[model samples]
Target: MAGRRRWSTEEILDAAAELLRTSDADSFSVRKLAAALGTDSSSLYRHFRSKTELLRAVADRILLAAMDDYSPEGDWKQRITSLALHVREAFGQQPQLASVWGRHASSGTGSRLVMEEVLQALSASGLPDEDIPARYHRIAVLLAALITSEARVSTVTPEEYEQGMELFRVAVLGADPERFPALSRFAREVRPLGVDRRAAFEEILAAQLAHIEDAVHPD
Candidate 1:
């Protein structure tokens, strides 16, 4: 007789998510998840038809988690900023998932809802009807890039991170004063901030928000 199903769908998903959080998301596989759950690979296939489907479900779960306690009550810029920050924090908590977000392409209900909220905010931002699509695309791509890059950095080893910082310091501090005046002049101030990813992300996000504000109200 067939053995009683040992794992519920929710149980399987929870274990899969934990695995993704604690390991390399890009290398996630059904067999590995099954092993982690103390089951055979075929057992996992009984719940999810394939690894791709499982990944989609996991990605959607992350998306929905990002929307927890999210409030849609605010001006356009406020709305976008809140959503962006919430999403970033959610991914920061699960850097492995964020690292593989682009590869998954999850367009499930959660993904659709997020897109809807952002698009609505963009429409309400006072941009011309024709420009809204392009602006939305730009914002989405930039946000994805920023979060993915942060996740990648979080996964690196101490040695690799130190090496990266050293390379950055060399490039910044070695810039010639005559040709690269600004970098040379601010090298003292900038070199120390090289490892401050949160600060860098905030600066970039602020600049993007300012540019969007300019587009809407060019005064």
Candidate 2:
């Protein structure tokens, strides 16, 4: 008779991440993950105390994969921008993991490394010592909002997304022109143009970095 299957933490996380990548976040479960690994839920529970813990571990695994030994280059603005873009790319690639990110705060190696890098960048940003924490929090909140907002869009089927966008466009364009003239005009002119999410992300990052620069060299 075969002995019991033994799973390492790294193997468990890898399998969990693959399951998440291919499955809907709302429907993912430890039982499902164990089935995928050809094991029982008891095996997974031995490694992870709960589904929430498992999800957070999977998120950290993705983040570490995204970092991939990357160290940011150039000044503080450049460094933070590089880090943020790496994280955004990871979430964009595996949007189900965004749900994990949105729900849990990672205290694992991956997240700790990321936090350390960001703090170091902020320290080098020329902000007064008293101001680093606030600025760091501001940037963290902004990146989380922007990255997760885009990731949410990525989780849907393309046809579903386009259909939803069309509905939104119609609602905006159909609004009473007299009552919402500005909105009507913008909807007709700009809404139809479509959004380039990468470009938009870069633009927002630039604005945020500029604000940091301003704090350092205020007029």
Candidate 3:
């Protein structure tokens, strides 16, 4: 067997991210993390009091890694949109990490950088200096919520979702056509469980962008 390697914090964080990306939210854990790092679980206890701490550090690094993919090019609006989508995709790429993101304490600088960039993007949009923070917060929350919800929703496998659709059809659409005319009528037009999540996401993103644009450039 190869000798145990002394992993730096960065390397450990990277490993933590790998662990999250490849494992389910329930099974991948700090013990697994330590094993992947070629160290004893007890050794990690010195640096992190709990699993949450170690994972949060890993998540923070993951956030930083995301910035490399965020171009932030184009006009102010386009730049912000690009950045938001990139950030969203970053979290979406790692479902386990997204499941617990921002819930634990963190000392990482990635969140700060993201915040700074968003605010700067707002400033470039010709938003008033005093208004940038609120606008940034609004955009940030929407992007985070969308990505987090995507992660949660994606937890269900395609087969499971189809099962759910069948259940929904029986429970609601099949209950009473007269009592649930609107739903039944809609169900007639649409498949029981064939809602396009990507389409819904695009609509939501467009609405949020329009909402923010109105706030920043109100007539």
Against the hidden reference, what TM-scores do the models get? 0.82, 0.91, 0.80
Q: Model 1: runs farther than 4 Å from truth?
A: 1-4, 166-186, 192-194
Candidate lDDT values, in order: 0.82, 0.83, 0.72
Q: Write the residue-wise lDDT of candidate 1 on 97-201 in tens digits.
A: 886676665777778878999889988888888998888888888888998888888877899879988888899999899999999999878844337787787
Better of 1 and 2 by TM-score: 2
Distance from true location, Cα of 133 in model 3, Å: 1.7
Instruction: Estimate the TM-score for candidate 3.
Output: 0.80
Candidate 1 at residue 171, lDDT? 92
Give the per-residue lDDT digits (tens) of candidate 3, residues 1-219: 986666677677777778777775467677888888779887767777888788778777657878887777887777776776676677767766876664552457887777878787778877679877777777767766776777776767789888887797687667577887877778656653235655666677768667777877789
Judged by whole-model lDDT over C-alpha atoms, candidate 2 comes out at 0.83
Best by TM-score: 2
**By TM-score, how accurate is candidate 1?**
0.82
